[model samples]
Target: MAVRHLGEFVVIVCLTLVTSGSSYAEQLPNVVFILADDYGFNDVGYHGRLHGSAILTPNLDRLAGEGVKLENYYVQPICSPTRSQLMSGRYQIHTGLQHGVIRPPQPNCLPLDEVTLPQKLKENGYATNMVGKWHIGFYLDACLPTERGFDSYFGYLIGAEDYYTHMRSYNVGSKTLSGYDLHANKTTVYQYKGQYSTHLFTNKTIDVIERHDKTKPLFIYLAYQAVHFPLEVPDSYMDPYMNITDKNRRTYAGMVSCMDEGVGNVTRALKEAGLYDNTIIIFSTDNGGPIQSGANNWPLRGSKGSLWEGGIHGVGFVHSPLLPTSVKGTVNHELIHVSDWLPTIVAGIAGGALNGTKPLDGYNVWSSISGTASSPRKEILHNIDSLYIAPEILPSYFDGEDFLWRFLARVLEDKFDTSIRAALRVGDWKIKTGPDASASDVWQPPAESGLHTIYPIEKPNQKVWLFNITADPLERTDLSGKYPDVVDEFLQRLEEYYKGSVPVRYPDPDLEADPALHGGSWGPWE
Candidate 1:
């Protein structure tokens, strides 16, 4: 049970935060969290993919040199779950959304009960604004970004929308909300007349910052939609890609460059607003880039949707005025997870409830990485939640096609609790298992003869893999055969986490009555 401290008071005061061990600073620097969509680790100039390893982003490169580069950052294998962890500070399993698209009336989406980062920060006097793709939970007035604590919400409620069309498949109470609503909270904000997703999101960010309550600080959650899918890039901007060898990749490069410029614009906005000094800015992507769609996350295998290191290991740069010049440009290789953002930002602001802060599954990565202190994370956790079918379990997941997407979608559509999978990574080691209980979709023998891999037993269901990710990041080695003890130990931890866990649900909030109030509810969606 959470002990609610009716700290419902919203106070905005202008003062400096000093660390002389002398006085307490009243005003906190504005925080801007820029989460880009489908940006691979090697896509930026800082990480070295910009301009096809040719042209460079002087601004972004300079930003990394000014901030701390997180060398071992890990997000979810996909987007919505990553957003859930970033906002709720909970593991993906804790939230209802285990896999696939998060639509309205999605009983599996983040239960209306989880408290989001903005909800916590808003209580501390910052005006919160969210603009760009929000895949955390359902889509509706109740499940929208504002309901999750953002003062202003602008962005698509779905995964990927057409760059020009701004159209997407949707469902409300099992019915879709298409066409008009896309413009309501998404595509139309900031007078986004005809700009592509990358450009419009950037401009909206500036507008939010410019129109912010200056007397009070601001917390801007800018999750941009670019380089994700539908190959949406303005012809004028993408025509340059024709000169490149690969058409798809060339276009991807153009989209990424546009996102880089968008980021550049935000920083300039900070400077213009005179908030750059004390501001704390973070830039990261929701997941790995698309391998089929011209993504270059080499040296690491797998793309968006898989459990491979490439799928989860994205890049991060933290630039806060609080750090010393020496700490700047210092790369911290600590294993940091996305769940850490909420608690860390809350701690930094000296706001909300940290007393019984649920021993968050994530650490305040900045504290140690920024030289405030030093410590190393023992293990990290990630989940694809890709398979939550019911009634019966399938023996294998299709490595290539998305027939599985439709299949898994139906498992929930038909209401069945058929799968459970969890993982624990001790250093570079990992373990995962499928739910063995349930009367749902049992795997039938393949008419073809070559389905089984190792022992060649035609079993109903089994999916397990262990790897020394640091040594074999692509996960091709399959160290499970060689390191049984390492696998056993991590597997024990994973099981313990599963058996000892309680389900978490997103809470509905009376935001109109009190914009910062948070509540949640949870039940068996199947």
Candidate 2:
């Protein structure tokens, strides 16, 4: 490992760390966890995969320059599941969310029995704060952030909302304007209506940091609603992208740029408050960008909803002065999962292991990030979901006697069946099995200059495909036929892993009380 000196600070961009022998004092380091919703792989400058992206994310690039880029970080395919795993350090199947997200007004949430990150951190004398996008579940007050573990909560309750009005939309043309989404500590604050949500969330985060008591360590979870759907941005942001003729793509770029600026403001606030050096900053995306939302996860396979590489693999980095100066501006190719953050953060502050609790599917990966040790995470069960045919079992999937029966069977039986969609990554090999494995969400480049291509649906395949992901990150060739023994061993392992999983927890839709909110269409309740 080569090292250089920048002023009195040693700089090392790509090397292992030699510990500085820093000791834990009375003032533990502050944590600022920044999560981007549906951010793309190629959208940032550091990835070096997207040849010429219109997006300019200077703040994110700066973060990469200041810290270690996690080259092999993995996350769940969608918002709620990823957030669930992140919060509890467990799989979504164990936590009551398996296939999709938690729709509003449904009596569902992160299971009360499970321990959350904030809960554990609060026990360790940290001020827990959350700003923006808490999509886990909020039907009941107990399910909300304030009731969970966050000392303070400021953000929208449901999924994607109108960037300006903050109203939850049911379809492209219909939105419940009266249904208030924005809130500050469980109370709706509509006065900030018409304000750009991305800016408002950033302002709230900074305010928290400014007013935070310095006596104890702080935990700030800033989840940005940027570059998602319902695209809207200030003219100043979009003006620079006028050369890009694709209007949706142009708006998307502006949104990303606005987010980048917000990140700059956040780090700036930390410096202004003299808390920059004592902070551990984490920047990562919730899931892959959706093509319909004009996101470009190029050179990877799938989109936000599928189990392919694009949907699960995401951007991540950790910046902190606590790490040895020798690790600055480096890249860590260690495998990390969303579930690892809680234990990792806890261990970093509490100075001990979280033993005597339920065994977690995640491991503390701080050593992996600091380059002190190789990643302990050797394999990950990406996901296992069956065809969720809502039409056939609408109310039963959520409520009613049928739901009770299904729920009981799920928890009581060894329900791992052949009819399931799943993916597993162990060592250098990745194996995916399902009816939808071959379905590609990749958007092709346009033949005409300056125009963005439309989203195309790839034909599905029923057979499995195996690849040595380390060698073939693009998954260009299937090695299953040539390596039959390897494929068989992986299949057996996947099956055993599946049988050990808990049943999927379905929230009650309660149709009689509230109708199912359909996307891309709107109608009155039945």
Candidate 3:
């Protein structure tokens, strides 16, 4: 089989296909995909981080106890890239989102041609719906989730929004676009003014489940905005974490608590709807935590946006009442990726095959996840530092004072062959560089609570480190010089993967260059 790139807290469900036989083909389990934004490795209780730690996630812990925890799940370091991979069942590189993110006013979006998970589920007779953040695209009406695949789409379009006011702001060119972004299937739901976003999304998910037509199985993607940024939570939620001391950490903990409550509410709704046991639920974080946002990836190196395990490895689990009773509460050490969910879900529900225009990077990992067979994944392309930027499409500021921006522009526009950062894991051995061999700080978490900040430093002549992750989960030791052959083999594999990646795509520069055309607003919709 081909190689693929491939951790998390617990939430609870077990989905067993009544019989291993095909007699009940029409009785597909309802699929509930719950995604947390900017969550971390040690943040969930099952990871042995919340016992006495500042982090608290009881719902996730209970879920972990009743479900299967994926100890080695992988995602991209950033939000949009991971979301793109999750939806399309391919790497971000294959979906034109190899670098940075899809910021506001940029017309760039997931290519419409790519068939998303919801789209495939819909094709198989499921009532597909989505709630919360949809950061892939929004400039064009066609790029919206409803038009893409989902029958309904609710929540904010940008990467982050004020949880209370549902407002978002983005700066591009000279325009700073700000507006109330809560929407219901492309139309803004103005009546929900001042409501906390976490609660709102949860209530909507429950409502969808309650109102769903039972004749057809449902596919609900509850993508919560909680715990991301603009860190805000209700007093009730924040009150429990008063002992956290640090204001940001306190609020962050509250946000997680509130979201955990929401998860409880949703699962309760499933039971109320008489669909709990026959439903398949998967809970996962979009990406690693960003320290700037009060997130902690304790004991793991690096924060969000870095190429370290802490940045991409997240808390995740698979729960379904139908899952084999014996494997319940088991920890699956199998390597898995966010993209694998699409095919896995499709196969789980109707056993349909992938018919996307491009070949998929995800595999049907149900066998491994269910403990019925070994994992098909052996390696993964962590990240490749390359983007096909179109210079003519960039604003005149391409030559401006921002050196990092300028360097990125050069890489994209000039088609420069520069390997700024790359990592690949073949078997238990992995190799990576800090922005193309220039050393970057390996962030280590403090032993106790304290304010900390990391500043990136360059070491142009720094040596690359290799680790046997199985022997060193913390990635503390460097075995490069000790195992030269392993490093060489992985490097060759990384290069091969980079050579096959698709070019990056961006929005029309003209659309973002004009302040009046930048997409955003602030008034309530009638």
Candidate 4:
């Protein structure tokens, strides 16, 4: 046996020949990764059984029942971070996307040198296709999906856009710039103007499946634009949720249902194309739902942009006829991060090599998901963002008659600077540093309940928070005061991670990216 090093990856070469009856002789399975935008923790029907949610997600529920549901999965707090990590198999700190998302006009994108998941699949004799939102970056043609290892791409270049009009508006300097965002590969597609993105992307996915060559495996990354902002959906889809008084939640539910229907349609297409038997379907959300936009995380605390479980604890599941019967229809509580998908699919499933790639922070968890072994990952570096700014201080639980006194007392004897926004998870313990006074740090319930309650806000002086997530998943109790030693250890770990982080790539919005200047379409300007 000999060991060979390829970039940061290690490959072992066995000198002995393998038997013809080995499992490695089998064909590779097709992969379909569906990513939902701004999906809440409690919005799915499977979670509704415990939270009594009014959202209708029959298709998603059925898919979960036939697969291993990921109850303890984690994503980044925003769109680009999660997507970048999913594509690169690296953390945000490694990719320089540690803070915020790629704004429409920013002269930035995922570093071009990074080896993406699609590229790896393509190397393994797979047809790679991408449909829907490409929010990572588009300032350069090198940043487009087609240029990033995908054979074909159909999607918007930025984040949220009008569902029917297919238009996105953002301020470039003093002017609010608006343009058509729908595209097919590198060309701006205008024919899809009136078509809803959820259905449009779904149809494209089916087309890809129907036209795929059977001899070669297929890899589809369907990043749906559903359940995101804009709050627009056809009225027919919302009729069932008319009971919900809140207009936004009602529309949001309809959006979810429409996406669910699309999922069922895609599955049906796969079956019709004879690809279902060997296809592995994985579903996950980009981040937690934004509470201000009529989405609810409910029992989980915090909203989209915060460092709480509600912001990063995502909905994920894996379904395939290839999975063992013992693992199907089971809930997995093991810790899994979004970055694990790249290696899991490339090396674990496709039997591909990871040569020429950078050091991957992800581990292939196929054995764990397949019920053969426990997860190899025990710790996850959530993030270390130096650019994070705490929201405006408001008079909540942090302010009272004795607030000034307590603030001065804790400030004088602080163990770690709480202003450094970072979080880390080691085994059952999770630690977060930085001020947690963001408006997104509140539990949002379903709109149909018509019940509103105020929760205690984190004290202003309290910069560090420690929670045993396995014991207290809701994160209601803060053990920082009780276990100061644990907090110190986690802080030191965070510091080590911070030292390895590259400079953030958030650049100022460029006027050249204005749609009016680019024939009314958003595309590469550099």
Candidate 5:
């Protein structure tokens, strides 16, 4: 066994496999990582079993039923953080992306020195291609996908954009500026102006699959911009969801269905290209859904921007014909984070080397996914966001009859500063510290269900919370009062993580990033 130190995590590599001849390398599996933006926990069809939900996802449900469903999967609370972690196989704190999504005007992106998953796969002879959203960064050519080890790239540089026009608008100081964001290998292409992005991305992926050579393994990162904000979809797609009374939800469901159909089409393309047997398709959401925008994380608390279970507990699954017969169609409850994908695919499946990369925070969880062994990971550092601002407490909270006594009791019992928005999970225990009032913190059932649950509002001063997440997945009960020792231990762990974290990389919006200065398209401006 070759022991490779990856920052704080020690990765044990098998020398025999690493030194093997071409015969061993030829057996590597083709990987297709499909990432959905702002997808909710209870939005998929498989979860419809719980409440007879109306949201439809036939292709996604079929994919999960044929593969292993990751019931305990986790992702960051927002887009850029999860993408950075997935690409670098490191936590957001290590990458200095611990704050928020990469703004369109910020001159910030994934560090240039970081070895991305695609770059590593390419070194092992895989053909790396990317389609759809690339939100990590775009202030320089070095930050573009093609420059970062991808053989070819087709996508938008920033996050949200108009689905049809492919236009994105950003506030540059006092003026709002808009530009076309669609790109093909660093070139802005205007031919796709009227094409729907979901279908457009799907077609491009199929083209890649159809043109791929069978001799070499393939890697595709299809990061769909579906089901995010703006809530736009073709009328035909929304026709089936007329029963959904909420207009935003109806559009949202249509967007999900469109993405699902694209998945099915891509799967068909893989089969037609004779790559189905050796391909591994992994589907995951970038973060939890924002309930205010027609998304629901029913029975789970919080939305996209918070550290609550609903915000970080993501939807994920691995679909491949190569999975063990016994593990097929089963749910794996082992803990798995988004960062684990790099090692799980690059090292575990592709027989690649991680020798030159920086220390990785991810673990190779292939055995756990394959039902051969338990997950090597037991703890997940969800985040330590120093820049997070808790919502202002309402005056009603202070005006309550027993507010004085309750406030005193909380002040005395609090073990850590709640003003710092941070969360950590160890074993079954999860601790949250900081003031979080995201309004979307309550459970949001499907709009069509006409159901709502009232949750207690957090007091302005109350910050620390402890919960045995496994026992109370809904987060309805805070055990900070019942377990002082657990709270102390978790707080200590958070402090340790904070001490090692890099300073946040959030930069002020650069005026140079204005698309008006760059041919009416968002691209490298610095």
Candidate 6:
């Protein structure tokens, strides 16, 4: 084994640590997850996204104040991957889904067999309710929320929707305002008439909480479709920001504020129902925002679909009344990834939640929150898209494959620079490996030159190399040639990490296909 790989193993080992059945702290706590669409890192009051802006997110601000605020957090580069990671506790590729924010008649959705977080929680006696967007994938109806484990489901299977109309269009035959219906026990019993996406979803969640059997706790995965594209502010929120200068951004801010209010409503409902203290509400975005969604991500470059920090890095947290003082208001600096949600939540609920799967990828931050331990990921891989050399359940299999292909073709024309495009930041050192020269300009490796080398560390002077990320967060300078030994080690780790991905099976097919009935979709980003 190479010394660099050895160093990487050491880093991962320190992360593994030792654990047993339960830590006593892993008690039964109700779970509520609010996933914002196209949300930026600094958008909320806690993160200063709305600090000097006209946007007012008082609800989220209050939530952060009452609970803990997480700074060092991450999701996939786009919506699909994040939902994939959120549900299966595995990497996007492993889950068998590709494409972020799929169009209606969306193809190649999440595969069946992946054990969802709700299913795991259900095993330990938690009623699961999923309301709002279910954008994991929708080639078929099986991908819906209820099929995956939600006892009750209400929301569009696609990514985003027209708030007022409860209907929108992606194409001629593929347009339908009414989203699919998902149910666990009785189909008609769970049937509902969808309203303005946000309000309707929130009302359903409140109803679920209000009517849930308090005996067995509950897990509500509230995936909000707010603040995404096809931007529209409900009449209520639009009145305030409607008067702003930038029409798009004004409505965008209004959408964000309305979403924040929705979150507040849910939290208020929890408190009103007396479930607030016992519940652990996790807040995060499915992915970053796009150009049309509003430029909330300033300091960070890129947005939504791009693989930059602004695209993959979004705000997130696990708010529980039981959070230890050490972890509260503290930004966990350890390395973390998307797949950890399953085990992390399990770790919180302990015996009350699940016992089927071992620690997959994500670490339970609770112990670290208690100041008893820290996470292992220091230098993390924040790839937004699937790194699959090939894809399973490819688009060719779907009847709508041709349509999706055309969409992809149109999107590729204005594609971002892949060559010299993507970058990586390991502590202070940053290495940028853009879209392959061959990928865009057909620059062949070896035929020209493509050797793995490190940056900022010099041993054998190499010209095109890496740099110190801390001193130059923008990664303006290339010091790979300046430092050979250090560069070589870091380069090796990147190689192995890219080459290594333990694939997990897709979730149950019925669950995956349940939400896509009647060819429903969430516009461009859905």
TM-scores of the candidates in the order shown: 0.76, 0.84, 0.86, 0.91, 0.91, 0.73
Clash totals, every prediction: 22, 2, 25, 1, 1, 45
- Predicted candidate 2 versus true structure: per-residue lDDT over 1-526, tens digit per residue: 0111111111121111221233224456788999999987777866632545767888899888889999899998899999988888887756657778877645577887777888888888889999999988776667789888999999987788789988764431243323557888867777998999999999999999899888778899999988789889998998987887778778888899899999999999998887776788999899987766767676677778877787889899998776667678998899899988877777643443465335577777776677667778888888877544323234435676587777688567543332367788999999877644224445433111343544433333334668899998866677877898887788777777766667776654544223234221211223
Of models 1 and 3, which has the larger TM-score?
Answer: 3
Candidate 3 residues 1-526, lDDT tens each?
A: 2322210011111232353343323566788999999987767766636423466688888887899999888888889988988898888767778877877667678988888998888888889999999989776788888988899888888788888888776665685666667888867677888999999999999999999987787899999998898889988888877777668777887898899899989999998988786688899998888765667776677778877787888889988777778789989898888888887787644455566536888777877777766778777777775542223334443456896787787556543222346677777877875352112245544223553534434344443568888888667777877988876677667656766877767644333423234344422221
1-526, model 5: which lDDT tens digit per residue? 1222232121113222332343333456789999999999988999855864688899999999999999999999999999999999999898899998999999999999999999999999999999999999999999999999899999998989999999989887698878899999988999998999999999999999999977788999999989899898889999999998889899999999999999999999998888887788999999999988988888689899889998999999999877778889999999999999888877877767777878888888887887767888888999998887455443544677888886787567654445678999999999998766559678777888878756765654777888999999888889999999888899878877887899999999988887889998899987
Ranking by lDDT: 5, 4, 2, 3, 1, 6
lDDT of 4 by residue, 314-395 (tens): 9999998777788889999877899998888887666688776788888787767877667788899989888773443334
Give stretches of model 3 more than 4 Å off: 1-26, 48-52, 387-418, 436-460, 507-526
Better of 1 and 2 by TM-score: 2
Quality of model 5 by C-alpha lDDT: 0.86
Across 147-193, the per-residue lDDT of candidate 1 in tens digits comes to 77887877776667677656554443353434322333422432453
Put the candidates in TM-score order, highest first.
Answer: 5, 4, 3, 2, 1, 6
Give lDDT per model, in order.
Answer: 0.63, 0.74, 0.74, 0.85, 0.86, 0.58
Candidate with the larger lDDT of 2 and 4: 4
What are the C-alpha RMSDs, in order, of all predicted structures? 10.3, 7.7, 6.6, 5.4, 5.1, 11.4
Clashing pairs in 2: 13-330, 398-508
Q: Using TM-score as the measure, name the better of candidate 1 and candidate 4.
A: 4
lDDT of 1 at 345: 76
